[model samples]
Target chain A: MILIRVHKECKRFISKCLKHNINLITIKSDKDDLIVKIHDNDLEEIVRLNYYSQIEIIKYYGIKGVLLNLRKYFFDYIMLLIFLIALYFISNIIIKIDINHENTALKERVNGLLIEKGIEVFTYRKDITDLNEISNAIVEENKDFLDWMSINRVGMKYVVSFEERIINDISEESGNCHIVAKKDGVITKIVADHGVTLVEKGDYVREGDIIISGEITLNEEVKDTTCASGEVLGETWYKVNITVPFAYQDKKYSDKSRYNFYLNGNYFYKKNYDHYDEEVIFKLDIFGNNFKIVKQKEYELSDLQYTKEEARKIALEESSKRLLEKIGQNSTVLEQKVLKETVNNSTIEMEIFIVVEENIGTTRMFEVGEEIDTE
Target chain B: MLDIIKSYISNEKFYIIIMDSAIYIKNYSKIINIADDEIIIEISGTLYKIKGSSFSLTKSINRELEIKGYVESVDKL
Candidate 1:
């Protein structure tokens, strides 16, 4: 909008404009001038002619309105472009999934199980709504595998929890079962709940001895065939022999911090997959998740590896741990034999045989097809 | 030639005058520089650096005085 006035009260300019039949969308008049708001294209020639400079053309518009006119081009074009670019960077671009399970096999099984329910792997993008349905499907189909389940959506990630099904072998309904000695040993003690015991305290029994019987009889009549169930701590013996190479080389670089990101089931990393080296390997399972590191990282590797005397010592310690696991808890070591000993090229090798005393028992239950009536 | 040269030098204080055999300054010799007892004028660049007392003399030559300082160092910067 521009304000214009003529020096003389003549209508020379106005008359010419009227004769030319110019179209102005908005026009107003004040004490001595005409205020015309016209589009930029049409007002070019009018301003060029200088028809109003001879007279005083005062602007009465406020500063706010003047600034608004100046910002029309800047805000409508430049600022809008800048705002859209900022929005693109702040938006979420990746989707993450959190799997909660103690067993990798079961977790993978559940993932495969979810695929059966139409949940594709990194292909079809799904949100919490699909997550909820997948959870429901897992709960319905894997009743025997999972104890409980839950699905959650945290930001752009989908988390699923599959609680493990803990099956306790001992219960009141397991009366149709029998406990047998898993190793040849002398029974040190016995605790029974049902069925007849075939061995007594200080009684020597071999492997497969029925410590508690599942059959029952009274007055020459068939009464009950229940599981013989009880804990019978027996004095079991074992001989274990282990050998280690004297000259062995173990991997010194165990700082394997595998940072993995998956996009469409693809992996990227810098670890050399082709190099063969000396290393000791072991696996540690926390809850149901497996982490590979240090001495545990070298175990079960698809590459050739060896360990020196120091790592061999650690490997011996790990082997002792495995032996303890097989023997159950803390057991007494009766005798040890060093079958062979050798040393080579910064390596110490020895073959040692050991004897251990332990308690081994296994409970077997026979399920009855008929129900017992309690009167 | 002298009559013609004297007629052309009448209205100017400094003019080119051609005499019988040599050229001469009409009222004074061609002043290559303007100097005074307290100042010196050096025309080393496109313009003259009027130092000390010669500033007033150089100032008098306003329309003809050109300050030839480096344009890129000041104006363009």
Candidate 2:
């Protein structure tokens, strides 16, 4: 841009100047004249027109103007640009790792895993996908010890938090306790460790009857109370009544399956597997939009009918399963018999008697002098 | 063909407007004479005279010129 002074009367010369479509800006300088700013390219032609022989360019603007003013401070501008680039690189480098957990051993273990995955200090920050994968891998590797682990990035630092897994155990449980009969059964055996043996083998004990007492007895006087550490194996009986329909449908799953998803989850297009069960393998919600992946296991159905003998056999097996579920895995199904059976057109009902040998003992804590059974 | 030429001629007709202290001229092809108090410009085939005081003409897009001054008279010759 070019700025020039023009006499007021010659403003008509401005009109003559306009006849050529020259881009210019006019500012009223005083009562007698004005300053006209135009493109530098138009100055040569405007001067050639002979209307104004004295159009002096007072100052430059635009790129040309910037260059004219910045020529003296070029080095400073270059140094500033370099400083900004260095700041960008420094901001992205990981400087410190903060493991925010109470367990120092667990913290060190997690730090080792993180460093193994290139997540230590003074390294470039990993992308979001890599960080998420590393978190999942570490959690899966130590599933028994770690309940959940999360790694989050805050500026140039990595912040980690986790929870340790806790499990329940049965030893000398429920302090100051006695091993009582959990079921009304005949005592088949007794194994005592820390408590006074109350019932002998082959004794008929009722529910809530103590098999081993935590109180120490001395000449009809009580001494000290301790948790009973023993198990009482007994013979128990159960009469279970069951009814099952003779005609039933059985489902068998085939190996053919398909994956399905929408939204942020990975796109997968498999052939549609019809008549199937859908299991969601992965799911995450983002801003109320569901991203999901489903595994479809296709199943085929077959109709089956059981005869009277077959029904009886199945009923006995089911009865054993039901009994074990109640008495736990250490029980043995010693005997079974069907006492009554009633059948209709499509169903069979039966009352089955079953005998099981199981350890019928669970701890029940007691306070001092709570019926310590004097001999 | 004739309609297109006629339409072009009508569209190119010069127009002049006088308001307060300014005169606006459109489709002016040349400035035959100009001074502080008076200016003559050719519009189409006719010559138009603008008599005013302290005339300053500014040309913008669409061949439109704005002249600002004390307007006395405008005539076509």
Candidate 3:
């Protein structure tokens, strides 16, 4: 068998071989090559007699060029193996949605409602339309909610929004609760809308005095009774005390580093990779109109040096912040003093005492049986 | 087997032995650069060179040198 790349015209070569008394048993022609088979005895004579001019017959038939082809190689089939593996991995990675809400009972109710409408917590990734459908379903279900609120996840964080419900006012027929001044002070002002006020601006009201009355009397006969629900702005005096530490032995994370990954709210990390330089990643959560996102910053955490003055200042500021959150915002500091200081090995502990005057008066019903239920 | 070049140290000279081929150098000599196209060495206050497309030599910073064409062997004259 002979294989050669030629421009065409294999039949002319076979016909010429037959004319030379050579048995051209087989002939095959392709786009760029031709193959012919003959007896080796005829091939030897054809070369000796220089009768290989069958190529001239090909040339006469417009065959352009001819060349021999030697095919010998192995097969590994490696590229086809990699293509199948890539297709297997890509088909499994998908997105999943998880809802984390505070009210477990309400969440179960909502989950059941959504599942009835073909939206379940464990539903497949392809079934979700949008999260708004779930939120709208909740609002449609709870019509009596006075302060209905919802928090949803936008991408990776939760966004909370709420609507305040106003409670309807009851008519004033039976005797309602009357709010009175609890301290001895001069009434700066009074707002009496549903009830009758017995005192006005600049009126000196003693402790347990009735600034507004719940009963409306005419000609010494009971006409109606209403709730004395109004503010009595008074010049009230108070005394507050706070304590602080002058120094502290703080335990902080060293320059040791640990890399962690979290999935489904669980943290996972390798136990071996520990030694790192001075950088620590700090993440702070910030709220936006759509969702909440974490802002991460890399901080170089240095070893804490002993500083008594800085510790004292930090303690005082911390105590003041805690006090203000409990008291009203209008409260002003009247006095402050470092009452005590105790220095230990690595910590110089101190206490800061403070006093302030703030408004701290709120009213509750004093009835024996009527109590408002809260959930 | 003829392509394999093995190196060893003699009493006072370094010897390279291959199939039907041998080379010798003084004890103070060492192979400084060997490339696919050439082999260079410093021997006893003299320089010896051999040129051929023989083997691969890697330079610092990960560069390869390949010798091509005819091989010409030389010794210190």
Candidate 4:
């Protein structure tokens, strides 16, 4: 709505002129001010009369004026139109490809394979159907490594998942072998099948000694040869050495923290600390614009003193942890004892002896035409 | 052809549009009287009296004017 500012007596003058039929045109009043619509000739005549009222143009509007302005700034409108088109085109393409696998090499291989099949980052989603065919082809090409594969599209990103094939050992299938001791130990128990037991309980055995023989004899003549399979349990000992320090430096954090933000490599607040832990709150990258928020927590390091009991407990725990790591996963711990412990001014040293019952027999394949050298 | 041109140029027929709470007039000639509750407008050679509460003139251009308020009645005078 447009409004014209005029003198206070403008309404009275216009109304008097209208009554005289002086072609005064449209005239309306608010208290003392008047709104008048007159032709150019009539307005000129009014001004010539030198009336006490004044007039001023306040606002104007028409379709022709709007179209003229749009024509004048045509390039800006064109740029806006192009920007919208580009946004629509970019949103439909894949921005990232995430392969869910623990092995980096396998993930890279799968990604390379997908790219070779015309599927990768920045590829249009509409152009990349037939994912099942692609996955089948990949699995077929990598049958020895990939057991199953699948691809899924999620919000401009392609998520790929696959499982690796696990190959079993083939030596167990061929039973033409003998059981030999893998480590020197005392035999605690033995159970033999399809072979002759060469070691008995409480018998001292050495590494590379045959525990079970695969040869079978009948009437003092060679009958047949089969793989010797048995479980020979033996008691193995290990000595674990560990040292614990009485004084150490530990990190202590303050209750206060500060937040910082960055946009396109420019920091919002510039404050640096010597000892602080930074945690990323959020990071965003859209159309090459980067933004990040980080929280920094300040901390200090202080010396901590340990008592005799604390040092001894730490030493024992460390020794036991070291011994457990040395023992294999399938072995059972039979007994454990701390053989010796020595305490110094600032350190404590200890030796732990561990005895475990484990399978000591390993298969040794023999050639069929080889002479039996049982010396 | 000259007569047609003269007729087209001299065409001064008035048009009045009464919408909800607003009145628009084209080819308006004058304003006869204006009050807080009523307003009288001259268009072509006839007078139109608009009665309402809190009447206001919102806009004015060449031969055109717009009135806005609670319009109760419109009568030709």
TM-score per model over all chains: 0.44, 0.43, 0.36, 0.47
Best-matching candidate per DockQ: 4
Q: Is the docking of candidate 4 incorrect, acceptable, medium or high quality?
A: incorrect
Candidate 4 per-residue lDDT, tens place, A1-375, comes to 223456656655655454444443445664666766555445555655526767764433366446666887789989989999878867876778899999999999998999897667655663335888888899999999999998888888888999999876434566567788889889998999668887799998888888887767677665787888889989888787878889988899988689999889887987676688889787655456666788989888889988888887877667656666666667777777778888899888888787878889888887665664433
lDDT of 2 by residue, A302-370 (tens): 999988888878888888998799768889998998899999888889999999899898888788778
TM-score between candidate 4 and the true structure: 0.47
Pick the winner on lDDT between candidates 2 and 3: 2
Model 2 clashes, total count: 0
Q: Which pairs of residues collide in candidate 2?
A: none
Lowest summed lDDT window (length 10), candidate 3 chain A? A65-74
lDDT of each: 0.51, 0.77, 0.47, 0.74
List the TM values for chain B, per candidate.
0.23, 0.74, 0.43, 0.73
Chain A TM-score, each candidate:
0.50, 0.50, 0.41, 0.52
lDDT of the structure predicted as candidate 2: 0.77
Residue-pair clash count for candidate 4: 0
Which regions of candidate 3 deviate over 4 angstroms? A1-7, A10-175, A181-211, A216-224, A232-312, A327-375, B1-77
Task: Give the winner by lDDT.
Answer: 2
Better TM-score candidate (2, 3): 2
* Model 3: lDDT to the true structure: 0.47
State the weakest 10-residue window (summed lDDT) of model 4 chain A.
A16-25
